[model samples]
Target chain A: MFYDNEMTLSFRAISSNEAFARVSVAAFALQLDPAVSEITEIKTAVSEAVTNSIIHAYDNGDGIVHIWCGCAGNKLYIEISDNGKGIENIETAMEPLFTTKPEQERSGLGFTIMQSFMNNIEVSSELGRGTKVTMEKSIGE
Target chain B: MSVGFKTLNNCLIVEIDGEIDHHFVDNVKKSIDSQAVQKGYSNIIFDFKNVDFMDSAGIGMIIGRYKFTKKNGGITSVACLSDNLKRIMMVSGLYRIIKIYNTVEEATKAV
Candidate 1:
């Protein structure tokens, strides 16, 4: 069987849009017939990525967060990006419990949760430019 | 999302309805914190029976509350977790600092 689908969404980098982004991605991935647990994991990962963009990239100022999703042959691909202040160091940022905003009560487990939930995750950024996170997960065997 | 609080014997049981994520966490945190302060309650029991989804933001909120409660010589506990929420809780290592109960009554009694 050959299965292929793709979608792109862009919205303001605001807190309210976090739920909208994750639910929309989960709905799109429903075509793969993912299990409930799998769907939950995907939604969690998406939420983390989008939250990062809103809090870190845009600094809760004013910007747009973009999401691109494509599924091919039981595999889901997601790319969340923001054109805001980017990470200074990708390596340190990916480390567990590493957050710049500890005063905000951040657990710094966003990247860790995404890494564990998805099969693969890659982050790329240019300081003072922007950041993009790409992740992949297989659904329903 | 709506949050209902029940205070029983100095323990505030927070009954959360709907999803817990970055979008609505601020409200939940504000509600619970203010209630805790106004009622002079220290310990908090989060009843997750009705919550369907949560993410890292939920983890942050819980940890924040836990820290605050701990400073006040109180405890933080969670009750009635679904499998998905359990997975997230375990992955985050929240079990180390927060107690888990099977039911709201158990959590309230523990406090």
Candidate 2:
């Protein structure tokens, strides 16, 4: 089924907006009538993706995070993108424990958590250009 | 998020309220660390009964505390985790290093 509904949000890449971003996405996802666990999982995935954009992509203290969410039938789709410093190596960034900012005490589990919660995830990036993460999940499965 | 601290049985009980995320993690960490130092308590038990959400930032904070307590010959444990939080904990392999209890009272007695 094609996505019948969608919403887009763009916010400053700030830590305070992390919770705001996830809550907004989760609210939009309520139309799917997802189970409590399913919604919680979606919220977590949103949080992780937003955190990566704010902390890693815009670590230089400036950038905007864009999120686009769409839903159709029982499936939800999400795309989070940032135009800050792009990832140098997408493969290394996706690894479970490979974090470039170890000094910040990052667990480097952001992508892992997103993958665990969503049905599938894809990442694309270009040096000095930007990074985009797309994730999909089927609810009530 | 709001954090409440108390010293029970020589264990620092850090009760966290509301969402645990990157936005509030630094403040939470500072509060817990300062309380532990002032009270001279090495063992710490996180009370998450009221936590609405958590992410990787919480995991990092927990691991950092685990190392701090372990180096001080103490232990770090969590109490009152929702099933959703437990799922994240499992994915992060945090259960390998710390223990979980049904209540802070049980953790205080054990730690």
Across all candidates, the chain A TM-score values are: 0.97, 0.97
Candidate 2: share of reference interface contacts reproduced: 0.85
DockQ of 2: 0.89
TM-score of each: 0.97, 0.98
User: What TM-score quantifies how close candidate 1 is to the native fold?
Assistant: 0.97
Q: Roughly what TM-score does model 2 have, to 2 decimal places?
A: 0.98
DockQ, every prediction: 0.86, 0.89
Candidate 2, residues B61-80, lDDT tens digits: the string is 99989988998899999999
What is the C-alpha lDDT profile of model 1 across B42-106, one tens digit per residue?
A: 99999999998999889999999998899888988999999999898999998888888999888
Q: Relative to the unseen true structure, what is the C-alpha lDDT of residue A70 in candidate 2, on a scale of 0 to 100?
A: 96
By DockQ, the best candidate is 2
The TM-score leader among the candidates is 2
The residue-by-residue lDDT of candidate 2 on A23-131, one tens digit each, is 9999999999999998899999999999998888888398999999999888999999999788998988999988998877799999999999999999998878889
In model 2, what is chain B's TM-score?
0.96
* lDDT string, candidate 1, A2-116, tens digits: 4489999999999999989999999999999999999999999999999999999998899999999999988999999999999999999999889999988788999999999
Per lDDT, the best of the predicted structures is: 1
